[model samples]
Target: MQINGSVALVSGANRGIGRSFVEALLARGAAKVYAGARQPERLADLVDAGKGRLVPLKLDITQPADIAAAAGRCRDVTLLVNNAGINLQAGLIAAHDLAAARAEMETNYFGPLAMCRAFAPILQGNGGGAVINMLSILARVNLPMYGSLSASKAAALSLTQGVRAELATHGTLVVAVMPGAVDTEMERNFPPPKLAPAEAARAALDAVEQGAEEVYPGDMASGMSQGLAADAKAVEKDLAKYLPA
Candidate 1:
């Protein structure tokens, strides 16, 4: 499905990669973009920036009522971007926050799953649209800081594949967009040398326009992907060097 002139919905669109997605969609000529966030007020700037191209929708992916209401309201939606997620609260396998881990799963893993389930039918009814899930290369690698995030994204990758197969008949385009540390609020305090959100968003849109099933965006993502395919154990060992001591 071409992004140009499509009715698109992007969750977590208030900041970071989601915000970049909203901008990219407008640039690609999307007819209308329903930008979703936990606090719709946060998207005021986007609405103002888009000058009528962006529509704010209040949504909390973990909430069933929110999902149902969004699905109903955006019934004409043809492009769905699941960009909401959370991070690890403690070190890998740390018992410090089992509850936090569970919460991460709800937002990082089950959140996309829920959106897909709710919007799959709408996309089908609209004559086969595209669904893009923002994932991390951490899905293929484990790091101390990414324990919960890695597990969650790996589950989401599986969900993307499974959903793709199941929704094939519906002509739905399910794509998993894997990228490394984006220069966004998520990584603002981490350090330098991160891919800009604008660049990552552009790469993803390019891949989608080319009908790619999976996309690895940016140098970090591409490098990590290649390393994993060549020797995952070696990559794991090497990635350890970059982790904080």
Candidate 2:
């Protein structure tokens, strides 16, 4: 889990927290980083700035073929950051977009799971490399306004735990990073107390280095996690205020 000299691969590295992770990894002296994005052209500037240390990878995490291709090509990777995800503002009830909800589950939960499955052996081969999953506070408690997205993240949390248990034998460190309303395009519509993408990325990389299995990056996520641990029902009731419009 040392960042320096470690080869890393990050999904959705074109923008948002994913892009921040690429920058942080480079700043921390990672030997090389494979920046994965749906459109590799979007990463042209990063590739230029990388000065050969950054390699742009064509990847759409939701596609099994893309996952396979990434695994096949990035064999030297020692760290996998599952940062690709989406939230279409769907809910479980009351005029929510079922299609959008399904998309959330596909991208948020299944994509990461597939990436982990595909790369587990590669990580083991690379001497027990680590995996960092970008989760959210919503993974712990449902926000009725985006209940579908919450459910998807909850599933991802479970997936992270299960992967952690299964990969324990190889010593792969599976880290789950939960942050609230990261200041990225993904959360542009959210309220205050949002964490800067760089800060969140730094926290996640810190967790990877410290061997922390779970990290809550900001005050909002930290408070929500504490509230869930203290009183699950109360947290649910509080989040219910944001029910779907």
Candidate 3:
């Protein structure tokens, strides 16, 4: 699960934590990084800087065709970072329609699940590498404001565990990274004390190298997880008050 000399593929590499993952992988001396994004041109700078080590691939995790294509193209991948996700900011009860909630599940939950399904064999063939799923602290405790997103992440967390068990025979390491309130455009209007994407990305990679099954990347995430472990109801009640911005 080491980063150095690994052939990695990171979905949603255009920006946010995904972009940070790509940068960190390069800095760690990865042999090659296939940056997956909806628009490949957005990764031109990274490709140039990679000097042939970074391969940009068009990928939309919600689309089966895109996942199939990426799996075919990045067959040598030893590490898969499922960083592609969407937050509709929809509430289970307050939202006008179910469309946004459905979209959230498609991207945040089903997307990573599909990637794992497609890449498991590739990783098995390449020596059972690793899969890192970018989750959230909200996954452990449902925040009423973004209930749909939280629920999707929660489902993803469950999927991560199942995948880990199934991939154990192949030696693929599955790491669920739950970071609280990352300082990204998606959380621009969110409360302060957010962890920077780069910091979160680094923490996640470190956990992978250390062979941790689950990682709470920042102080907030770690603290919140601890709280949930102690009193799940208290944490749920506390998060129930915050409304979407």
Question: What's the lDDT for all of these models?
Answer: 0.87, 0.93, 0.93
- Identify the runs in model 2 with alpha carbons over 4 angstroms from their true place: none
Q: Which digits, one per residue and each the tens of the lDDT, describe model 3 over residues 130-205?
A: 9999999888989988989999999999999999999999999999999999999888988899899999899989
Which parts of model 1 are misplaced by more than 4 Å? 241-245
Q: After superposition, how far is residue 231 of candidate 1 from its true place, in Å?
A: 1.1
Error of 3 at 230 (Å): 1.2
lDDT of 3: 0.93
Which whole-number lDDT from 0 to 100 does residue 29 have in model 1? Answer: 95
Write one digit per residue (lDDT tens) for candidate 1, span 131-193: 999998988787666676677888899999999999999999888899988888777667768
For 57-92, candidate 2 gives per-residue lDDT tens digits of 999998989999999999998999999999888668
